[model samples]
Target: MKIKQYRTQFIQELSPLYDAYEAESFFYLILEEKHNLRQIDVALNHELIFSESEIWVWNSLLAELKKEVPIQYLMGKTNFYGLDFEVNEDVLIPRPETEELVEWIINENLKAQKFKKLKILDIGTGSGCIAISLAKNIPNARVFALDVSKEALKTAKKNSENNKVDVTFIHQSILEIDDLKNDFDIIVSNPPYVRNLEKKEIKNNVLNYEPHLALFVEDTDALIFYRKIAEIAQKNLTENGQLFFEINQYLGEDMKALLEEMNFKNIELKKDIYGNDRMIFCNVSKTS
Candidate 1:
């Protein structure tokens, strides 16, 4: 059948699960991945058709999409911070809000007049998106990433290599580590801040498919990772070194209070494009 006709049917079948815009986006993404045809190419070539085998492949993918599998996982890759990353069930798919956090780090460090080599650490570095992006953007940065999952580290290591950035990957749980070992000029984490109670707020694509170990915490101790990372940061951060986090929106005040109790100075809570309290920044106090 003509590819355009199939595209219409694809959207119609998926309409019950996904909005038209999202479904159409998925179609183009698959078209580019499987057929190497851009949207413009499809529009221009009215005679283009899918072979029987191609239709079978598309249909199989459609069934999975209806099951609410993330498109990034379906494609086995995603784009973050202008870099392409390999993704799978093992790693949490990088999100746009995390891009903002990376941009903030890059921008702040870029403004410094002293261009010295800086050591950076990314705790809970799923997919190595934040660490790799920092290494790519901040030329003077030596980046290290740590994660608890061996499977997640495997995906993260491949992504660093694919992105052509040299990031040291550590397969250790931050919660259990006594010390970070090296003093870092910047320390950042987007740890498991989503609490168990917040599961109802999550979409099926995330709640069902994304790795829960990287996405959630007990409702009673939602700040467990944050508190642990901050304690380590206090010991490991260089004087005036910065700390950053992508936090759960509902717990902004809780995060602020945690940082304050840790004696973090110059604390700043920032919102994402959606105006959710999604990021926080602070520095280790000189007295601490």
Candidate 2:
């Protein structure tokens, strides 16, 4: 079948579930991923037809799309902060808002003079996206990432190798670390911030497919990770060390308050591109 004809069928099949344009775009993305053929390539090389086996493979992918499986998961990779990462059901898809979080950290900490080496820790580093991007962008930073799941860390370790950046991947829950590393100049996390009560607001595609361990917190204890992290940050972060988070948009004030109470000084909350209060920043106290 021609590229155009296959796309038409793909769209027709998916239109009931998704919009026409999204279905068409997803069709093209799948082609690019599976066949290494872009939209223009498909147009110019109409004679470049799929072999019988290739058609079978394409048909299988089409069936998965019909189930609303994420294309990133289907391809087993995603681009985050301009780097390709291996992703699966084991890890969360890195979002653009998380890119904003990376930007905030890079822009906030970049210093020109000595090319100072900074030690940074990323807690709940699902895909190692935060730690890897920081290590890549901040030349002198030594980075470490911790994830509760060994399987997710395996993916993150592969991403670190694929990206040619050095990040120490640790398999441990943040809540389990008792002694402070006490070496990091900065600490950051994009932890579980979604309250379970807000699950109704979640779209079906994400709610059904993405990893829930990376997404949800009990409504009554919405600040559980933040509070625990802040407590640990007090002991681990360098004096005047900066702490950053891509936050639950609804809990900005609460997050700030929690940090301040935990003795994180100079706390500030920032909004994402959508104008939602979705990021929080603070610094370690210099004195009692």
Best by TM-score: 1
lDDT of 2 by residue, 1-288 (tens): 677777778889989888999988888888888778898987887767777787788788878878878888998999999999999998999999999999999998886315678999999999899999999999878899999999999999999999999998888898877656566888999999899889999877788899999999999999888888888888888888889988999888888788767777778899999999989999888684
Q: What lDDT, from 0 to 1, does candidate 2 have?
A: 0.87
lDDT of each: 0.94, 0.87
TM-score of 2: 0.95
RMSD of each: 0.9, 1.6
**How many steric overlaps are in each model, in order?**
0, 0
Error of 1 at 196 (Å): 1.0
